[model samples]
Target: MSESAASYKQLKEEFVSGLSGGPVGEIVAVTAVLPIAALVWCLLQKRHAFFKPYTALGNVVDYLLNVGAALLAITLYANSAVLLMVLLLVPALFVLGVPPSTGARRKKPKLPPAAKSYNSNDSKDDTGSSSSSRDFDVLSTKPFLTFFRGSMMVLTCLSILAVDFRIFPRRFAKVETWGTSLMDVGVGAFVYSAGLVAARPVLKERAAHAGGRRAMAATLPRRLAQACRHSLPLLVLGVVRLLSVKGLDYAEHVTEYGVHWNFFFTLALLPPFVAIFQSALKIIPSYAALALILGVTYQVVLESTDLKAYILTAPRVDLFSRNREGICSFVGYLAIFLAGQDTGMYVLPRKINPRSGSSNATQRTTLLMTMAIWCSIWSALYFLTTDYKYGAGLSVSRRLANLPYILAVAALGSLQLFTYCLIETLCFPEFYSAADPKAEKEAYNVATSRVLRAYNRNGLAIFLLANVLTGLVNMTVPTLDASPLASMAILVAYSAVLTGVAVTLDAFDMNIKLS
Candidate 1:
């Protein structure tokens, strides 16, 4: 007899449910390996010359050492406790560019301003991923952003395939509900990342044609059209994904997003919603306040009414009920997305302030202080709202994406992003202080691994590829009973294929732009 969707759901339920996650600090530490290797490899990029005249081989080596290290960090975690601890410590210490005993960090001298020629070329594509922007007041290189995004994507890529295997730890899987886990954190992380990059960019390649002044007022129709332009592709992709899953009779955990809903649809909706509601969302105090308000209101409805019951236990009988989780949880995800934008607003250097004559050191310090404040506030909120603290003793549910989940995401996201920023500051102090956009970008380009940058740039393609490969593997191989050694071997090979594609794409100067 063929396995039904209900059977598939039950199998996965037996696999992932009824478990609280492992220690946050442990997962956080293992994750730190990716950035640590990336940033350090960037600083020591010249060492890759061992493969001179055969640069492709160098890319292979870089992938094995840097990207590959992240895989090993997961599969071999039990065996490398000391190394993981050390990887965790380097970021904690060097982020400050000072010793535990040091009073203050020594500042580096600033580079002269770039000849105004690079303004047009600095900001590239709609993503406004380039740190050197003509639209923003501040412009600095941000490999840290790339590193963080890549790390999360890689973790996601590896875990999706690995989870089917016995060697994959259940504690890291998505909990049934009301608890934290690695996969749960990833859901919020993606929402946060989307908002982080979609912060309206203050970016326009052709702003110069419009009197060379950034338009303070973009019309509502234009905003919606542009948001549609970006988000519609994802919607199309969502439809494609749905068709493929149903056509293949793929086993899907319907509760994840619901019968017809997936993350693509959820993610696609965000840009337009954000476009329509940004002004209202950016209410008093900060963007995050609106996020908190939305989450709290949603939680109140869930708690006060039968909405939570309807969400968790309702039959997938109708269209709305089929996608209830995606529809209802949207409010919480939007809150996370908005909070991410709020973070990007601060972390991204929008415009250079000419009046203050501020050095990058001073700017970094100020940003660090702001991050510290955010961290303290959110961490306290999380503790206070949890069952362990003085409040209602709520549990974090990825399924519901409750207020507690948002709070946890904010607290952890702040700390993680802060660490990434610190890595960039320490890895490339010249980047912050340098005035030449083209030159600083070149220097940054040289220091960071092209392989990582490839994954970072065309992340959507990588994700698509990983998903297809995961399905293919599951169809062909019996992953559920694979031994640890067999699982590790398969995982490493899978990761290598992903990395090789990234390297090849980087070599060809191709960016898939699907993202």
Candidate 2:
């Protein structure tokens, strides 16, 4: 047999041999700790660079706590009673309605100049109501939002687990149903709409931050130039992948559950448009408005018309089968992702100036409130959608910034960041700086440093590696019908192994490009 066949045979044997719980347990064990170790190594290498050991250590602790978030997602995916309970409990860290203790109350602050000026301007108006001209100030503390974010993060991670492990098979079975088709289109539309909304804020923020027309033009030209530079190589890779021997004939096998041939296509085509959309958020009255419009409209289209059948059944036919339906479906989902980001931003601004006299207790309370809100949402959604299996609809970009697949996206991003933080504290204390120097170390008057600088710097690289690994694992793993425990074990192990390999390869100045 050929080398590839032989490798598959070996993997199969491993699978059979690991039928008991040992392999899966070990896999989880490695995932649970290796990340922390790797983080420690990264930090010590950078320890001499004006870092705060204690603060760095704390960051690491936060990161590990974040890993607990993965359990929330596993529960969502597994839909097991145990997992669900975990999910429910995890969000208590951020829910809003939970009783506030004396330790949790935030003291109100005297209005800062920015707020005072705005109020004075408001009072000057004869009608005292300028809804259209109103400028909503970014809050120093978004207690409600914090909870929402924390809950969403947990739920999102859980969703990823569900999609990958196929825990809730009954929900997944809906893939064969007409309702699934409608849901797909509706979800797709929602994702796309949200993306458009989210883009608005980003664009506005950039435009405002730009010094002047000349300055803005300078940045635009450079950004555009950068895009142009990247495009050529990406195009070439596409062409080669299309004709190469390793090509999987994705078009011919479009119906396969785990096929991920179009990630690059989706990533490349959608972002530019989404960026433009995000800029428009500044003009919109509310990001939620955009989400509602898109969701309602998509729902109407899917349910009230023949769009679903045409998109799903007809698009699969030979003449129309160039993956048009799949592409369309994803476009819709992009809207959802965009919307989620926009809503998130609206609720939680990027910049927050803490009240000068605010007590630490208040800050902690705010954090808990955010966590509580997040938990409630997860719990509610869980109960409501127990029988629903959206079946990894086009809404989820799989691993990359999925939109309507809100649960998965939130969990993964939040927990991933949390884990990253944890590793820094526990394994790599050196990298953690009490003050993030890169956040303009001597900025106007900020006290704390940003949480993710280097990680953000290398984010694209890390994300690409993760995506490729996930794709490869899907391609290599045994069929979904494989033994349940075996499948979960292999997936967990595969994810850990690929992540390790990717990080190591990155360290060595060697990177693998996914086709």
Candidate 3:
């Protein structure tokens, strides 16, 4: 056979071989099993009574169910089963259920004049509080959903990096992989979702200060200063990693972040950039629009120039060419972060009313409906953008962080939040009221909350630990050559160690907060 025919034959073999079980199968199998286990546990807990959605047991079941559904959807997509992935929508909606509302609203009794006067005075005092006091308030407010998200982010990062996961075909050509791949979505989602949480406080504090020209000017410098301070450690680490054996082979570098350009550098710089823009424009940039513009510009630039060629085959790895994706993708990631900030604006508030028994139910239902709508819209847009001629169809590209990829990450993150919200509202409604010390204490005592809080408290540390462990594993073990079972065993062991460390640190109040 001719060389061209041989090449084609090899490509066909690769495509066929790539369809086998890997991390995607493992995750899907686990997702399918966990819900069933949770259901069984719930049933055992409610031996004589019907399962109560508002009870702790019910909350556990709900959490498991939602997680399983989301995982199943993601895994299916990763495996190139787009139809099965789409079919998950119906069940996700059914599980999400309808929002329940009480037709009657409770009337608040009027306070005595003296009491009213005291409340007014308290409000004035709060308004006049120092910035430190406000910061403390922000620190104290640890929503369950936020904790859940942080934990999930850590878990997803581990799953992608620490194991032999099936990578979907890069494009929609003759290769047989479906929708957006998990590897592509993981890091972007992690960064963007975390950014959303981080931005809330900055925006809130700015609004509180009645952000004007002077405030904006002051804020920019402070944000820049903070960015520099945060970037220092990441820079040091990046340099160290690059100088070390890990950087010897360019192909081994998962993200060009530390080795070529630092993602932390991008992340650190983005806040100040956003702050400056917001200050100048006197409006927050629409994240969706920004993402669209950035993604399109990136595609245009790639198609219009030899930039792609330079990126792939530069004479030597340099700051610019080696880190082209790292640098260009910053805008896309920034847009994602901003979009996350918008999401945080909607999700961070505590909407459930403890006085209403059905409030939790209502909140869960609303989240489900909202996530479903957004997911569908994004999915449709993703398919619509497919350039069949070029064999590119919204495949998740961490390097590009394109529109479809952003939407998919946002949708997945939203679904994860919905699951956490269901658990928090149904199982521990009072947990939402951070202002109530008694409720907060009670909520913290719960087993689930304790584990989540542990992860939340030391999220950064846990992430760093995973990175270190991954490096160690790579150096010590033949990861690529290991059997699937062996790889998974290592992953499980790594995660367990990380979790144990996190929980122990939490117990000792030893959180490693880089920022």
Candidate 4:
């Protein structure tokens, strides 16, 4: 083969094979280290009861330990990490236990008269008004969930890039498997979800301002404008990144982003489009329909023509044909973003009161059921569309973000959310209350563990930090030459440094946001 062809072949082989596969191991290690380190730090601070169950710190420790234990089981016995993670929830729930409830005879807490603004004017009764207000409040208040979302994004980024350096098992990297890898599906879903969550405040504010018949009409233009503003910086960053890779002569995965299609570009562009559609239509169902239609269309086109090969091997890169995967996948990802917005609507309600039947147990049970149903329905859809016997099912192509890929992401993301909710509900029920800001802050500090809160507080900063460090590490270390144990150690140490930096910054109240 010619030098250029030989280079392409080498890159392809490198992408396909590397270290052993270990999605569960990487996830478990990353998740477990921070909380465990925090506990150790707490011990050093002379907090003797940090590991005791029922206390805030103890509850976090319990959850982390359970996660660790479950991961160990998956490593030793189970072939499916997703299934094992779900099954582990049973023991987690049992260990954490349910919140204590007020008896049926106890009267529900009275809402302040002024707080009634959360309710709709059309509410028929006090109970209806209270319910409406509470839901809205919960939607607006949950900082911890936002933090968790950011942290998940950071984790997904680290895992993927780590695999690039052979720091983690190569098998966990993106593959054309029947079911999707967690890391592969996670990164795109998290980015899209973050965009949706970030746009919620803007969406809600716009809707409120345009309350009359023109509400729908007025909101669309404003949201589109807002999305344009959001995308501008990302677009610039994407351009800078594209130029940097080309200029620096870094190893380029052509199919991953194509020549001009950076992730920053996708982030900059897709959310606004999704937001516009959402502003004009019913959010979840509409977007879900779009995803199905687009996915099917893409698949049919792929099978019928040489489009896939052309996209993969096209010589010239430009605004259109060569980057078709990146351009086309935006539709599917927007659908994912819309689905995330629907979830945010559900999980971030205005309030939750044990006395009003919107207790932690109720919420957790609801999320759990939703997760189960979605997973089952999506899995069935996958089997229906593609044959599993010959590994012919929908592959988790980040480039395609096809129907099965979307379903897998939605299901897995839901499972993650459910797990987090369960942990919060059982371990720190007091943190769920929207009424008392002081108490909520205290509960958040305890529930998340100080280190986690730090990471949460400076999520974007931590992500940037990881990227910079990753570059430095690649320059300094022979990553591909390292043993698995050395790679694991390096990853752990890298994560620890990130956690420390985040904690220190959060201590000084240095959390930064571009907008």
- Comparing 3 with 4 on lDDT, the higher-scoring candidate is 4
lDDT of 2 by residue, 354-431 (tens): 334344344344443453454354334323332245432333222222233343333223332334333333322221
Those runs of model 4 whose alpha carbons end farther than 4 Å from true positions after fitting are 1-151, 176-179, 206-218, 279-287, 300-306, 313-319, 351-368, 387-393
Better of 2 and 3 by lDDT: 3
lDDT by residue for model 3 (1-515), tens: 56754564344334333322233233333323322322233222222222222355544443333333333333333343445444543544443353322321122111112101122333333567532212223322444454455456444645544433332223311112224444445566667666667656654565557534244445667767766676666566556655553343322332333235755556556665565544543442555455555566766675589864555445555666557656766766776776676566556543322234454347556655665665565555555665465535545455555555566566665555555544454434444433334344434443133334566677766766776777677556655456656755675576556656775787688978765
Q: Residue by residue across 1-515, what tens digits does model 4's lDDT show? A: 46865565466346653323344344443343323332232332222223323345544453344223322322231344445444444543443353323431132222223221343554544654434433443244453464357446545545644654544444556653233454566665565457446545744654466444244444677768877887787787778778876665555555655566867777778657865676445553544455566567767786689876676556774668767767877766776776666566545544322235555456656755765665566556655655567546545555666666666666556655555554455444555543444445544554554545565566656766776677677556766667857766676577657766875787688967632
Using alpha carbons, what is the TM-score of model 4?
0.71
Model 2 misplacement above 4 A:
1-214, 217-246, 249-261, 276-283, 286-288, 315-321, 344-350, 353-489, 502-515
Best by TM-score: 1
Cα-based lDDT at residue 287, candidate 2: 47
| Candidate 2 local lDDT, residue 378 | 32
lDDT ranking of the models: 1, 4, 3, 2
RMSD, model 1, all Cα superposed? 6.6
- Candidate 3: residue 478 Cα off by (Å): 2.1
lDDT of residue 42 for candidate 4:
32
Task: Write the number of the candidate with greater lDDT, choosing between 1 and 3.
Answer: 1
Name the lDDT of candidate 4: 0.54
What TM-scores do the predictions have?
Answer: 0.84, 0.48, 0.66, 0.71
Candidate 2 least-lDDT 10 residues: 442-451
